[model samples]
Target: MATNTTTKKPAAAALAETAEARPERATRRAPAVVGPPLGEGQEPVTVTLSHHHRIDGTDYTPGAEITVSPDYARGLRGQGFVART
Candidate 1:
């Protein structure tokens, strides 16, 4: 039997990809169509809550929806919240 293998990017590459995709890097600083600019320096951030059928390492089910500000999300990003998927 033959084994299949493929080259994978490192964790740093994943992080870089995420950083590149951040809203802060928008090419044009356009105005927001709904309620102030998303993630603007001033004003509270808004996020939609979603319930997923599954989650990792957590005993809760079906899942939980949480709304967090951009500021709060930054903290969560470092604490494995972004890894939940």
Candidate 2:
């Protein structure tokens, strides 16, 4: 009878090998807003909120009007957060 001999790799070494064999995963980023490009020197627009929301670290209640860049206001409008009026 012949005795069988085998060597087992350490758990950490196996994990490192597995990780290196795998391809690097791409980093996630915020989705880009799809709309017209912002114009230079474009006047800001005032929009009234239809719901309580926060902007630029400032809290705003429903019906509160805040002036922001036209492009930003357009985004809010599209989301139904800003009143149409």
Best by lDDT: 2
lDDT of 2 by residue, 1-85 (tens): 9876988899999999999999999995322322244479787677788998866455779997777768888789889999866
Weakest lDDT window of 10 consecutive positions for candidate 2? 29-38
- Estimate candidate 1's RMSD in Å: 16.5
Task: Name the candidate that leads on TM-score.
Answer: 2
Look at candidate 1 and give me any clashing residue pairs: none
Clashes of 2: 0
User: Roughly what TM-score does model 2 have, to 2 decimal places?
Assistant: 0.52
- Candidate lDDT values, in order: 0.46, 0.74
